[model samples]
Target chain A: MADSFSLMQEQYAKILQTYLQEKNEIGLYHAQQFSKKVLENQISPEEVVSLHLDAIEKFFPDLPQGARDSFEFLLEVMMGYGMAYREHQSLRDKQKELETEINVAANMQQTFLPKEIPSVDSLDVGVISVPASKMSGDYYHFVKDENNCIGVAIADIIGKGVPAALCMSMIKYAMDSLPEQRLQPGALLENLNRVVEQNVASNMFITMMYGSYDPRVHHFYYSGAGHEPGFYYNYKTDSFEELYAKGLVLGITRDTTFREYHKKVEPGDFIVLLSDGVTECRTDEGFIEREELTRFIHQYKHLPAQEIVNNVFYQLEKLQGFQLRDDFSLIILRRKV
Target chain B: MSVQSNVEVRTEWGIVSARQAGRNLAKEIGFSSVDQARITTAISELARNIYLYAEKGEIIIEAVEEIHSTGVKHGIKITAKDKGPGIKNIRQVMEDGFTTSGGLGAGLPGVKRLMDEFDIDSVAGEGTEITTIKWNS
Candidate 1:
């Protein structure tokens, strides 16, 4: 009995030492646990308190009664401190749970993006999509229709993070369900807008550009929904022209009609599509003008389509000192006869 | 006028591009086959380091001309820079057998021995930059 009492005495001494040195919640938790253990061992609370006081008194043999009373008061306060520590631990655990949940959601968002660009006949396609953070507000998708015409869609969500990621996945599923609609850019955008208007939140909107290229006839059909204008490079003339259509952002108006534009793509000509993130890249002065981006396309017109996409992305990323503040996406389509 | 090419060393793709760019520039500078392999290997190591330690970085390949006391020397210089957690003990890190990532611990020392000139600049909490050169003999 005496031996077990001595061991319990030593355990309390160590707990008090830990609390004094580290002053952390873990140490206080240990103190509280030790006190409970003493009470369970048939020792009265007053006896447990006296035993702890005796241990400290052994270290300070000449301690005054006033000091002893204050030490006794501190022991009562330690009980309340332990309860607060337990609450803090639970809160920390909750925060960790939330962090892991966010990571899983981010990974789910990644799978919505196109795994690979389709190999279209007589056309070279290049795509570059970079998210500003773990979740992207920008989206790009590709679908090859029955007639071998490739359909391309580039979109930008109005916000970032989980909300944007969720909207993108919805867009992906909606587009997948309507593969036949890919042939007509106007109908495709209209169908997509209706889906967005009915399903997505009222405050949320999406800007998008959809196009289809028929390699046999070398004809391209495109439509936009308040998206940034893409450029067409005429290799023969060595000139660049912007492809524009009038429309409203999706989820804005149910009755909105998108204008479909058509152009005959000649051999060596290219079409460039990008989100506003690429056009609104911040510079020391301000946002870079869209004319500069077109000029870049004209300058690097000689390289392969993929190389041109890479070079332009590198130059834009460099302009912002390699830190992208928004989601950036660019797609290039070249007619290779 | 100077001709240079840059590849962002973000993944394996970047490493391959960096190595190809280095090898091509070395060939253009008229380096022998043995030197071309050495320069390409050095670029591979540096670019891999950026991808492993720093998530992303840039590799710049430039044509260099050095007017030394011996003669005018033409060469190719490759610079790899990244904004990442800089090496704390650079000297220790460069030792042949010391490694933090548990591979071979030979990347830095191997790069130093492969090139004619090697330099590294790093600041804790800031970033790291490594530059190497291969000269035509």
Candidate 2:
């Protein structure tokens, strides 16, 4: 009995040292369990020595079975805490990196988009393009080429992101090169389609609406390459006219032909161009339909060109449940007398 | 609730068309609005290479496991292969302003800088396969 008591004392002292060395409060909690074992005669002198050895192994924090036992389990809990802290820190770092990439990409895409419509006499124009991501696949541009031909395009690339941005650049350059393309919508689409097919992949395609407006005649000649129809409203008739001609998508098949549509805008006449993002928009009700869109346009017909554009976008934003799933693009042009 | 999914797109040109297809693929990958954009951007660059540089390829996107021992990232992996003109000098082609066609030359190099792991395999008169992986925290 005397020998056992003395050995237990030594073991207890050793365990206390481990708790201090490792600053393991949980270890201290388990030390009480060791003490109880002795009081209950559950631990023998040999077992006391083994417990002391375990305490020492855990002081270095590399005890393999260190955490399996009641005493070692406490120290293991502390180790878990430390590891979890490090893991959280690493995760935060990665999140920051992704955010930075998105910011830069979004900014680059923004530069490619037009912030404001060009100020043209006798023409009221407003446009909005929202990307489902930081960048989107839908591209719209308003350009007055070197020949002073106002070119407007609403193109939907087969996919989204930086690739769409790259493709948008391609479309801009191709249209610029074909400066002499006037009142020739079919030929213009043919040239653009050929360029896209040869330059891009055969599977990749673009559905675009390309048009050149002649300020002199107030006439718009437009070509469709599998794009959505544009609406032209004539105030004189108090009705809506459509500019839709069937054409194959660019890069689909090289020899695909395009159809041309012409419309003369009077002083109160206006034109609306949009990507499928608008027409295909969905909400809780169901897929946004074409007739519903016409109703929305007519509802806002009283507003000026820019105001109508803003109002239409506002309605779509609310109706689509505030989610811009695909690239949402819209352009409203009013002919000023 | 936000949902994320992992996808693998056959590097066929037909599948890549239609913005909805790519958009659906993006949403499935558990990407945030911003991550979705980066993912799409990365996909665009790689897909263009498959179509423009090679005749065919495949792209893989994987969702990262919450706890990974191998330190693997939770980003997408895109691999593309084509049997057209193999890049002669990878180093030169990796540089900006270096393009086989009259383009921005932002395809390969641009994708490399966007991801965590970027690899390439090519032989003259054969084809080229490029792989890129991005990570989410």
Candidate 3:
């Protein structure tokens, strides 16, 4: 460090001498080149000022005390600037590290989702989950067991980034261990709530909606844990009804009970399950009402289940200026038989 | 005597600065470590709310003194003000498990729980201002 400082001092002195003698563009060009060299060596602005002062003192031993005092003040100002610049650089590095970790966590989260949406003879299903950021706090899973009961679960962690991703993995493993509960939406939620309460932090919680559709019975049994209400489209009434269930969010308590609800599905009936991102979509006006969301669904109800979700997502995405404010997850299960 | 600090909350760094300013004021006011943590946490939530929803805002931390019939009470007050798109439904946002940000829905309610006194004023398209105080007991 001392050797580089001395070398830089020598170069600075030479540039100063040339600038004072010629006072032309050639001297200015050399000064710029010297600055580039100093930057490459990571010499701070204060250090450069110090080197300049050294050169000035050497060149003029009888320089006025007032002139020297100004140099000292300039040195102090440069020192503060240098410190702030270094601090900013370190903060940028930390932010980059955080971004990389989130990307890795996002990739790990992708594996937790169902690789393929299980095809059911009686149920036409479609799902779309998009994260506003690299790491998603929203999670969804599909389980098709031996009896061919299609179990679907959508959950949102009350947090974001790495911690949410870790909590999701825990939920995924906990759900996988409960094969019997898959057919019982309320029971599944009850067991998952226990896992969350025991494992996760007190400040963090998760809201989830889980449901299973039995093709044979044409019944969809669902449960919710403080989640946003979903919509149930009735073919007979040609209207939508809210799917509401009252329960505390998971991780709040170990003994909280989630109530089970069911709806009979006719040939043209469908169930729309979604995270709050769909219903609370913000635009120039404000949050879109649930009725507006239902209208979007009704408009695209004639298309295939997947097409409907995709189109709804596009419309909402457009409303928000093509930038989602939160993690968006939507699922539609239409009875085709 | 009242000492105030202002932090402009426009980015992640702004949230950090607001938290630091709140902690400093809380410490100077002789708040216990636990209370100081709570104050800082509340400030963090408010500052983050501005960064996320409002895009830009200001957080002011002030040492406050209130006089009552019994005695003089010392406390710290924090005010977060923003001119971004204001909340359309203040009641819904204050609910414990209602969040549009896909977060833990603990934003405003959590702040309320941490502080002794809380108040919020918002106008759609105008802006929002939240004032909260925690008295040393």
Candidate 4:
């Protein structure tokens, strides 16, 4: 095999030399070798072409810029394919890790969310929460203290991922550690804002909607922390009014003041506090028109809390070619005198 | 309503952004009393610990059978596990006002205080898992 390869190498070298010289006829050395391999005259044209390509690979001068560019493109294609394959593998690994982490975190976060709104003596409370992803930043909580006054809040942390989740931790701590739990909603937001600013990064923030209900008064007072304004449906007035408490988002301004807004919730009256996820929901038609959402709530003002939330989600889901880009959360509270 | 409910709590790093997620879930379920508040606090603190310290962890919440009939026997159990820089000293970490420059270490102690029962297992550089129970009354 070595001898034969050497012979072929010799032949190819001569052919290269002849090509370089621009000779029409085969060189002597090439002719002699070609004859030895095909003494019976069985040499095929394809063999000649194959031999010629090998010869060119060894001895051809550098290709022109255009030809070289094509070669580079071929290399690039190979590299691109390799990178794509690697990225797919990496994404799979990340996905598995994310899936596992999401499962864990979701569980932890879920424990904080109440299984059901406690049945206050004369108030009907129903709440629904859904995360935009495996994990989300939207949160709503209803805590009934010894006073039987329920403190309800729906908060949206700035940013997504682990950082926001951590902020929630600090917020919960401050809320839990408060020796004075019965402060006005504005004061509670004040303390929470300071705690969040002290703990969270400079870039992080949380938008929250908070309120307290005194069944005795049948009145609900609420405050907003840069979250969207909520709506109050008064059965007596047969109308809907917005709940807007002017306050800076937590972690943004410590000195910023928040005003507590109140609406007398009577029998058959309901308050709807929700994150921006619902209003910002995009549709083929457009982002959920704010007016339309308001109207939607007004239309179903008399429905039960669960039914109301379900209908909203149902509509959002049916939005053709629309997408839910954020976590949507809602809390419905009704006072039955 | 005398109904037995089950929930499992698990924690993982940067899993998602919506935190009050669990709180909302609790409201949807029937645990809306002091018991729910306790579990909710525990879950929040543990989850925050996982996010701030180890940069990652996982938790699972599931409903368990009822016991100790005082209020609602239905309760939620949380299991938080993470494989990030475990606590250097569990005792010190549990101490109030002894923050590790990573926000206040009010998490574990707070969690213990909030749960009907709280248990912790952790090793430095290994991981930590906190299991807690809250029974609705």
Tens-place lDDT digits, model 3, residues A1-337: 3347677888889889989988999999999898888867867566677788888999999999999878756764554345444444544666899788778878878988999999979889999999887778889999887788898999988766667778878888988887654458888899999999999989888999999999889999999999999999998899999988788899898898888888888999999999988887899999999999999999999999999999999999999999988889999999995
Best first by TM-score, ranked: 3, 1, 2, 4
Look at candidate 1 and give me any clashing residue pairs.
Answer: none
State the C-alpha lDDT per candidate: 0.82, 0.68, 0.85, 0.68
True contacts kept of 2: 0.00
Q: A1-337, model 2: which lDDT tens digit per residue?
A: 3336456656676767867878878878868787676746534233344455554664556755633355433432333232233333444566899789878877876776666666667677778788877777888877664555577888898777777767876776776688553546688789888889889866667899988777777888888998888888888988886768688889877898887777887888888899888888899877888878878888988777667777888898899778787788888878887
Fnat for model 4 comes to: 0.00
Indicate whether candidate 1 or candidate 3 has the larger TM-score: 3
Task: Rank candidates, lDDT, best first.
Answer: 3, 1, 2, 4
RMSD of each: 29.2, 20.4, 18.6, 27.3
* Candidate 4 per-residue C-alpha lDDT over A1-337 given as tens digits, one digit per residue, 9 for 90 to 100: 2335446656766767785787555565666666576433333232334445445556757645675445433432333233233334444666899899878987897776667787787887767677776567777777887778888989988665566666766676677787655878888888888888888888887999889998877778888889988878778778777777887888887687789888777788888888888777887677877677767766666677778777777777567244457777877888865
lDDT of 3 at A109: 84
How do the candidates rank by DockQ, highest first? 2, 3, 4, 1
Q: Which candidate is the best by TM-score?
A: 3
- Encode model 1's per-residue lDDT on A66-152: one tens digit a residue: 988775455444422332333334445668997899888878887888888888779999898888877888899988867788889
Fraction of native A-B contacts kept, per candidate = 0.00, 0.00, 0.00, 0.00
Model with the higher lDDT, candidate 1 or 2: 1
